[model samples]
Target: MRAVLQRVSEASVTINGKLHSEIQDGLLVLLGITHNDTDEDIEYLVGKITNMRIFSDEAGLMNKSVADVQGSILVVSQFTLHAATKKGNRPSFIAAARPDQAIPLYEKFLFRLESTGTVAVKAGVFGADMKVRLLNDGPVTIVLDSKDKF
Candidate 1:
């Protein structure tokens, strides 16, 4: 599993012109899954993401976690995050997990995130055509890969 985490002032997901999910003062997470990913990956990321102190403190120090600021989170499924572009201009999504293997993990991720009980969580529909919009706060972005935990 991999996630692109963007700190945002506000974010929303619109599908077919209809609003799906939205959040304010939070993290917009684009999550990708690979075939070998397992529950351990979800656990690792949930722990890190929930406790990550990317937000600023009252002293202007980047010391506050999203939960500390009572923020929200919007998760979007983005299979392209795992695209393999080594060989040619056309990026190969062969590394991306198929829906059968990914959807359950995605749902479990969402569930675990919500179970943290600190920040409110919203999610884009799995396998949906989603248009995401966000006002990036501090333009703070972080990339996390489960494979790197080792």
Candidate 2:
């Protein structure tokens, strides 16, 4: 699993011109799953995301976690994160998990994030055509991969 976490002041997802979900002062997470990903990966990422000290403190230092700021989170499925581009110009998605394998894990990740109970959690519809909009707070973005924790 891989995730791109963007600290956003506001974010929203639209599907078919209808608002699906939105958040304020939160993290907008683009998540990707592979066939090898398991519950352990979900656990690790959730722990890291919720506790990440990217939010600024009163002294203007990035010393506060999202929970400390009482922010929300918006998770969106992004299979393209696994795209392989070493070959031809066209990117290949061979590393991405199929919907049957990915959907459940995606749901589980969202559930785990919400279960923390410290912040509100919203999500974009999996496999849907979603238009995401966000004002990236501090323009702070972080990339995490379950395979690279070591």
Candidate 3:
């Protein structure tokens, strides 16, 4: 599992021109899953995402986690994150997990995240063409890959 975390003041997802979900003062998570991803990957990402200290504190230092700020989270599945482009101009999605294998992990991620009870969570429709909009807070963004940790 891999995730791109963007700290945002506000974010929303729209599908077919209809708003699906939205959040305020949170992270817009663009998640990608691979064939080998397991529950362990989900666990690791969730732990880090919820606890990572990226938000600023009153002292103007980056010391507060999303939970500390009582922010929400907006997750969106993005298979394209794993696109491979070394060989040619067209990116190859061979690294991205197929729906048969990825959907379960995707749902697990959301469930695991919500279980934390530390912040509100929302998600875009899996596999749908989603339009996402956000006002990036501090323009802070971080990328994490579960494969890197273990």
Candidate 4:
């Protein structure tokens, strides 16, 4: 499992010209999954993202977590995050989990994030062609990988 977290003032996901999900003053997370990913990955990321202090406080210091600031979250499934581009011009998606294996984990990740109670969480439909829009806040972005913990 992996995630690219972007702090945003606003974000939304649209499918077929219909808005699917949106949030304000929160983080927009693009999540990727692998076949080996488990519930532990979900647990780890949920904890880290909710507690991450990327938001600034009254002192102008980045001292506030999403929980502290009561911010929302918009999560989008992005298997392309795992694309392997080493060999040639065309990126290989062999490293990414197939939809059968990824969908369940993706849903679980979204559920876990929403359970954090830090903010009002929304999500883009899995396996859908989505158009995402965001107003990045501070342009603060972070990448996380479950494989790197060791």
The TM-score of predicted model 3 comes to 0.98
- Candidate 3 displacement at residue 148 in angstroms: 0.9
Against the hidden reference, what TM-scores do the models get?
Answer: 0.98, 0.99, 0.98, 0.97
Give per-residue lDDT, candidate 4, residue 76: 94
Compose the digit string of candidate 1's lDDT tens values, residues 4-87.
999999999999999999999989999999999999999999998989999999899999999999999999999999999889
Off by over 4 Å in 2: none
Candidate 3 lDDT, 1-150, residue by residue in tens: 999999999999999999999999999999999989999999999999999999999999999999999999999999999999999799999999999999999999999999999999999989999999999998899999999994
Q: How close to the true structure is residue 109 of candidate 4, measured as C-alpha lDDT?
A: 87
lDDT tens per residue, model 4, 11-99 = 99999999999999989999999879999999998888898899999998999998788889999999999999989899999989999
Pairs in clash, predicted candidate 1: none
Q: Scored by CA lDDT, what does every candidate get?
A: 0.96, 0.96, 0.97, 0.91
Worst 10 residues of 1 by lDDT: 82-91
Per-residue lDDT for 106 in model 1?
99
lDDT of candidate 2 over 1-150, digit per residue (tens): 999999999999999999999999989999999989999999999999999999999999999999999999999999999999999999999999999999999999999999989789999999999999999988999999998999
- Tell me how many residue pairs clash in candidate 3: 0
